[model samples]
Target: MRKGRGRRAVLAVLFTAGAVLLLGPGAGAGAGGPGSVRQDGERPSFRLRTHEPHTITPDEGDSIPPLTPAFGNTGPVAAPLGVALRVTVTDARFDTIALDTIPRNCYLAKYHRTLICEFSDAVPAGAAYELAEPLPKVSGDYYAVNGSYTYSVWPLGDPPAHTEDYTAQYERGKDTAVGLKPVAMSTLKGDGESTGDGEDTGDGEGTGDGEAKGGGEAKGGGELRFVSDGYADRADWGIEGIKLRGRIGEYAEASIPEPTGAAQRVRVEVPEGTSFAPLTRQEREGLPSEIDYCTRDAEDGNIYCSNPRWYVTLRVRIDRRVEGAEGRISVAEPGNGDTNPGNNTAPIKLEVEDGPTSIDRWVPPVSGFPVEHDVPLETAGSDDLASPPEPSVISVDGRTGVILLVAGASAVTLALEAFRRIRRARNRGGRRVTP
Candidate 1:
């Protein structure tokens, strides 16, 4: 009996030791436990993505939705490009998804349409992710509404220095073509007929249809006329001669004479097989009489004047009598206008439309500029540049709960074994107890 009791004592001690070992470490392994304390001094690096949500409304006669903003380029020099994006629609009835990465100002302009946005960042290559499902088109001419969508972006490869967030607002408009033309009485009247349908009931000599025939579709019909005596007047109107040329559309191939100091050239496009009349004597006579007033005498006795110094006022008329088509007519003299000639000198080519003809502005060849990396010496040894650790999500579900309950029961059993051991040891010397 003493040997049996000795074995019981040993069993009790073993069970108690095992219980303490299991429970002590297991309970202390939580997030804020000893291990976490050791890692507290370490910093984590991360890349972030951010963007605003957007809603768009179509104009009265437009058929397609506008271009939507997506993720732009990310990464410092020599780093791999990374991109992450998510687009989900809560309601799938009226919205359709189309992705594009055209670099215009700060927006995204719809391709082949009048919609425009101001997005001016390079998009990362090979980092596009889309989840698109078409919505049913609503019946009738009523506006179709799209359900709200949420978009989230993250770096796919490396963490970014910082994440950006933006929501977009879109507005749609009907697409229409603008016709440019030069001003002349006969040309204006002729344009009126071409631009208008056959309905000419308005004022006599007017097409009544509200359409104007722009410059009779003549080939090279509206070329600027220069005379041997030179152009008239400095500051004839509000425009500078050199600056004025930038605002007008080029329709023909023409050269400005280098020796004449003429910085501006005007040319107009005409339809195939059309010819324009030469400047009439009367029109030539109308040239400003003050032409010699702007001439400057150089040491060689040759006269010289900057093209911007001369300005003339030309009239513009639009004939809206035609029914279907519309037209514009502009006429201006060679010029330096009232404004400072040097003040308005932005690059004319830069101002020219760079994207599709339907749009008015140029998109940059590259969207986003790559990030620069030249850290200071003080920060070189810091762990702030370290990569972020992978994140693990904690979840509480039925299965987890069941496992926890089982663990708790196991722990309780361990306690009972330990208690039994202690009680038996305390009653060691006593007589046998009744069952």
Candidate 2:
């Protein structure tokens, strides 16, 4: 009877142990718990966080702080328009670094450790700077171990608009440094109207209806001519000689002498209703000094000289038929030579009697220098697109096996306790089990 009781007690304990195992923590899915399901469906993600070493938040009304003078081993440095910095760490031993500084509004963290440092405004436009060595690093007790870094900065704003009428030439050295070369005598001509347009009536020689009949010559008999000394001294560079002629209601023509050999004569017909203004030698230097002029009636406009080396002479041939129409030509100097070349060279004022039957004028080109450097060439092939690697699970703790062991031990302990209780109950009821 004792042996049967002991066997019954043992069987009761064994049955209780099995029931506990099937009903406890992980029993809902057999070998799979909620944690397992979550783990199987999740993926890994990463983020970056950065912080400045100093605590300096400017007040709303405070001006930006003056930049610290470049410190550390100094090489070459450019002034920065602004700076963005990122700091990151990867080891648990250095996690304290994250708490040492405030993360900028634009940063994040990954795995509670890794820190990414991005520094913009490292260099500035027009100003040069130097760096003696890589940014200083904190080690051992502070943050980051064996840190490595790289950086790049660009000119602060879009390349200044290239509107200076002068073509830019770039010269780049082996180190990718660039320099500018300027050409001053290049000219760009735009489209003009045809000779049939009723616009170019000569000064005061028009029939009052914007028309000049054939043989309707100027009452004041004079020829218009341009004169210039063929020298391009820095002070008086823009100079050229030419003549313009056309009938009213028709396109005018510009006849300029070529730069080479006694200035070869070339004629180009411009559209009618076109006005003309000849730039002075000073105003034609390049951008930052380019001059623009316009006129209501091209035939009577006066071309003023910006430099001492150039001048336009409009000779009027007064005829009996239009003698009552007084057409006087005047030249206005940009007074005192102290006026800002930019403002002093505003368009000249001209008044015509009936408008010229035709209008035309000769002007020098604003650009005439070879580019100093070749423009950057395009890449030969399509850029390679790199697909991001698929994310994989990464255990936060280095010893993942230890965590698994701990979980298994806890489950076993729970089963063992249940079995012991059952055996005690069985024994009290005259039933016992043996292992």
- The prediction achieving the highest TM-score against the true structure is 1
Model 1 ranges with Cα > 4 A deviation: 1-69, 73-82, 90-143, 146-150, 157-435
**Best by lDDT, which number?**
1
Error of 1 at 165 (Å): 22
lDDT string, candidate 1, 1-435, tens digits: 796677667666655555554455445333321112212221211111222223332333323232132321112221133222222232222222332222222122222211222211223332322212221221111122223332233223321222222223332222221111222223222221222221112111112232211101111111112121222334322212221111111111122222222233222221211111123467657777642112212323322322333332221111011223211111233333322344222211112212222113211111121111112223334552332343335445755755655665565576577667667876896658799
lDDT for each residue of candidate 2 in 1-435, tens digit (9 for 90 to 100) = 786567657666655555454455335442321112222221211101111222113231211111111211011333233222222232121222434332232222323322222233433222323222222222321111112221111122211112111112211112211111211111101122111212113221212221112111111111111112221112211123333343222222232222222211112212122333334556446524232222122332333222111121222111112222222122222112322223211121122234322223212122221111111112112231222233345445535655555555565566577667767866899855886
C-alpha displacement of 239 in model 1, angstroms? 59
- lDDT to native, each model: 0.27, 0.25
lDDT of 1 at 249: 19
TM-scores vs. true structure, each candidate:
0.19, 0.15
Could you tell me how far off, in angstroms, the CA of residue 237 lies in candidate 1 after the best superposition? Answer: 54
Query: Residue 103 lDDT in model 1?
Result: 21
Q: What TM-score does structure 2 among the candidates reach?
A: 0.15
